[model samples]
Target: MFWTGPLVTALILQFISLGGGQNNDPDVLLESSFPPAEPSLMNLNAICLHGSGRARYPASFFPPSGYAYARRAGKAVNRLEAWFSQCCYEEGAKGHGQILCCAKQAWEAALSHFCTEEFSTMTMAHECCQQRGEDRWNCFAKQAPNPSYQSLPGYLAPEVPPDRIVFTWDPYTC
Candidate 1:
């Protein structure tokens, strides 16, 4: 009987710890304690740095939220940003329209590939967003499968001469 008492107490303690001890209600535990951070130009610039003669787009071109709704979303966004920074440098005023179009297409493609299928609903995204600080972003980042980037045909054709091709962007899709 004495041994049973200790075992039961230990089990109860374990359960309480797992449940966060202070609150057993899951809803309460997941509730957002603060409002979401507003997206800033500085934050966007930090992610998409301008250098190496690459064409630089304004912060408005990037997503407003820092938290990626899916695993692939994070990678795709990062890749798109990097591509713009590296490949679009020589483009000048006349190329701004093309650059904007490409950025929009890439953003749409990334969001469509992952966000549309699973994290489409605001409720699902909210679940991760409610998590505090970096935990929230980390939680969302893990929600989808990571996709590998592949160069599209004609863009980086091995048969084509090296001097002829100046730049390439990998194709990403669902």
Candidate 2:
């Protein structure tokens, strides 16, 4: 078992200062993880597939409270990235609005999944989960480690499975 001692702390901190390492394959998971630093969500600069651009801190980046949360969070990121990749390659003709819509759906779905997991545990759901609509997004926006996803100097993303989410083009949904 990996201990969250100074060594691990220092390692994660190093990742923050000098960019994080790849998350490995989606099917294969790391042994253990520590939550992201409290103040800044810059712990890892998550790269979306197909050049869709960097995303806010993904659930896979910091994850929820425990190891059990890792698989779910990682899957959520995989789906998000997959949808982003589709948006990048397939939705180009549809305009950014459609791309953004896909993103929003994936994001909210991830959060809804997170809230479900939270309640599954002994702990109460995160405060932001209690809100809905723009309020939910606004609450999450405030908790971002940093406002923008800056490049991690020389970090690169690994190849993950192109998991897909069901998305239909409905302008009203956006």
TM-score of each: 0.28, 0.53
- Give a tens-digit lDDT track for model 1, residues 70-130: 2233233333444444434533312444444444344334333333433555445445544
lDDT of 1: 0.32
Minimum summed lDDT over a 10-residue window in model 2 is located at 32-41
Best by TM-score: 2
Lowest-scoring 10 consecutive residues by lDDT in candidate 1? 29-38
lDDT tens readout by residue for model 2, 1-174? 323344533444445333322343322232222111111223222323323332222434442344445555555445555555555466552655565565556556655665666667765566777788788767765654323332233334455645444644445766
* lDDT of model 2, residue 53: 32
Candidate 1 regions off by >4 Å?
1-70, 86-94, 116-174
